[model samples]
Target chain A: MAGARRERDIHAATLELLTEVGYDGLTIEGVAARSGVNKTTIYRWWPSKDALLGSAMVEADVLAIRLPDTGSLRGDLESLLRQIAALLTGPDTSPVVTALLGAATHRPELGEVVRRFFADRLGRELPMFERAVRRGELRDGVDPATVMDLLAGAVWVRALLRGQPPRPAYVRETVDLVLRGCTS
Target chain B: MAGARRERDIHAATLELLTEVGYDGLTIEGVAARSGVNKTTIYRWWPSKDALLGSAMVEADVLAIRLPDTGSLRGDLESLLRQIAALLTGPDTSPVVTALLGAATHRPELGEVVRRFFADRLGRELPMFERAVRRGELRDGVDPATVMDLLAGAVWVRALLRGQPPRPAYVRETVDLVLRGCTS
Candidate 1:
């Protein structure tokens, strides 16, 4: 039980270091220092610094937050985007995501983690769109997968490149644009 | 004259290495070795590897290709998308963009370079949409910037994450989705 507690302690410290120093600047020594644990303890649990961060990142609140079903695609999407906005603007998580993506250059597992997160989120939200299709709210032959990509990609572009925080209105607009097919 | 010539040779060699080694694996030592230029010269010109690649990326055909004016928004967009497709599918430029974006996680200049590239491209393309608006083809309050981000972001999401290459038809669908607003 103590060992398990210690391992959790190391993961928490790793996430702290990831947000502070970023992926490139994060070192095993730094994690050990921050966590008040021995470097050997960190190494004992994870193969490398990447593995530790990757494992800890999986436990981040960003992944744990469940998507709400607001009974309308528009409502659910707005809520989803608002949640993402909160995550992006919230303390440390933005930089954590940036660091994760940045570190993924060398560590392919990081990319896989990011990919899995997106896929999982998509998986949760996609059924809503599919329900819309079944109800004929969407056009025939509309690929829910493509729509998912577009919707998620829009927010990602703003976050990753524009460095602009997500706006609830922007998410609302995106949901409107995709669902109704953007009528003037 | 010789100094300028040498710089061009070095930049050219950097592109070659960019294609061969990608942005992640590209090192100053590798650039110097491959280009046959001294490492001192590279360090003298560029402060770091990201800086060297940032400049080389700007110099590459990535932004050098011109967007065509087909006298219609649809035609012009198709032309632009084709150019983007060419750039993405062309020799090493897309991967270079990805690599540079990968580096952007750690390096500020690289991120700026990417942002500037998007801004420039978006700046040029926004007017085309505006022209459509003037012709009453689009809504009066449509946000061209948002629209641009959506289209470009979709393409980028594919490039950066999905391991799926951008196709000309994907561009067409993107244009179609956005144009749906304009047409009504």
Candidate 2:
């Protein structure tokens, strides 16, 4: 129990540092100082700074996402995309997420963690498509993974690349467009 | 002519050091050493490291993209996306682009440059959609900008976020899906 509590403290400190300093400026030493955990302990648990930050992101943020099932794929997708947009645009998470994204480009380990995090989130949302397929809202063989990528990826571009907030109307339109493509 | 040659050498050296050291470790001093140019001259033209690198990216690489007009929206989009995929996955440009992306998160000026770079590319491709609309291949009121974001953003996610190469087949399918969404 003590170990688990200490791990939580480390994750919290990691996130705090990420938000304050951004990814490029972040270091294990800062995490150690902030968390009051020895640098050696952090190193023992996480092989590198990338590993610790990635793990902290998964533990504190990514895994917390819950996709709403509104009894229809479109409804569920809209809800989920909205949530994702909110998360990305939120004050605390936005900077951290953006930093992690930038860091992932240069670091292979961080890239692996990021991919796994998305895979897990996408995996959880797969059942929404399955239910839609059963309901005949989507054609057979419609890949839920691709749909997730399209929806989430569209929002990502607007939010991250364009520096625009993913508004409700825009998310709805994107969902409609993807649903139209899948259904027709 | 000598001045132009010196500028070209600087851009080349910048890309080289960007690839070798990654973005965070890169410095104007290294660039000057690699290019045999004075640091003061580089600073005279570019105010900061971000400005210099962003300028180098624009001059040396981004302006090289060329999209073939296959006389159909689908054909043109597929060709453009394929080119984008290849560019992102290519060794020479990928690291530079990735580093720029990460750097942009912390630097608003770099972010502006990145946004303008994409916007310019998208603007260059908008005529293809216009041609399609005139040729009756697309519905009236189908927004080219949104379509661009959807298509390019999807590829970006697959390439950057997922660490998956944007294969030709996948690019084609994405185009087909988006076209279907817009048309039907």
Candidate 3:
């Protein structure tokens, strides 16, 4: 297999087993078994469990969220939120993240990784808000984190707390609600 | 201890142990040992671990959130968000809920309890929004769930995802944003 493909497989396998057995039970050998990639290859590419977890988590969450550039800010926000809603209700609910978060409450190293990973992911969404502000869709001085949090947070509240899939209608309303709040 | 105080202590101890040892490790005896109540007394009330956990989780999350009616919708919301922010950033960071939620993805019984607990908790906040709409503070037909998920979700996003405290200012901004969104 190609090197990039092998890396993708390894990361995918790592997350798969991570969700299944949790962070504590995850092993490179299991990842190798799942991915059919060599454990030695995984170690050679990523030196430690933290390194592997950090890379996989960042790759999965940040890399997957492509900021859609719809002509209007509403379109852009709606598009972005729809993707996030899907991820939140989809495979992203893997207990591994929850299990890791649960452990991160106690484990500082894991906690730091989880924190940095989300900070980076959340930060990446800032450009969308900046664009909206530039286009006069959002009021001047609107904070991206605040907007993003309200938007994504709505999806999360439903998915995480309620365990409900945030349907398409819900996504549209959330975008509309947040946009109105920010612009008006 | 009196009946109410004893029950409170039992729930407190149950949540404490649930966070420390998780739902799997939690037991009636453990609650008894921690709360200074006898196992027989605990069983006489709760009957099973699920029953005990159901009582404790609901008591801790729902019963703790007292919606302050500060006359206006804005004040009431701000007060409510402040209390929720405290809980989300405070002791509510207990891994037991996360652990139970994670387990709920696979275990049906646990899943129902967790879902019902949050639905009931979320549902209890509706009167505030109803009052707001009645007072003309919010637009007619504003869905309480949407507003609430935005408010509480913002807190959860900061607390759970970023591992950061939802400061007073953040809580205030969230209420402001959601209120503006709804009213405008």
Best by DockQ: 3
List the candidate 3 regions with Cα displacement exceeding 4 Å. Answer: A36-40, A60-63, A91-106, A182-184, B36-40, B60-63, B91-108, B182-184
Model 2, range A1-184, lDDT digits (tens) per residue? 2288788888888888877786667899998999899988888899887778767867774326776879877788889989988888987678778777766776676788788877777788878877777777875555676667677888888888777798998888787777664221
Question: What TM-score do all the candidates reach, one by one?
Answer: 0.72, 0.83, 0.86
Pitting candidate 1 against candidate 2, the one with the higher TM-score is: 2
Prediction 3 TM-score vs. true: 0.86
- Candidate 2 displacement at residue B9 in angstroms: 4.0
Q: How displaced is residue B49 in candidate 1, in Å?
A: 9.5
Candidate 3, residues A21-105, lDDT tens digits: the string is 8778888889889999878888887888888888888775323778788867788778888887876666554355455655565
Candidate number of the best TM-score: 3
Candidate 1 lDDT score relative to the true structure: 0.67
| Residues B42-116, model 2: lDDT tens digits | 888887887787677667754367768898788888998888777788876787777777777777766777777
Predicted candidate 1, C-alpha RMSD: 5.5
Give the alpha carbon lDDT tens digit for every residue of A1-184 in model 1.
1276676777778777776776668888998888788888678777786667656765544435566777666676677767766666576566666766666655566667566556656677777776665555666555555665566678887877776766877887776676555335
Model 1: per-residue Cα lDDT over B6-31, one tens digit each = 77777777777765676667788998
Mark the regions of model 1 whose C-alpha exceeds 4 Å error after superposition. Answer: A1-14, A17-59, A181-184, B1-59, B85-91, B181-184
- Backbone steric clashes in candidate 1, count: 0
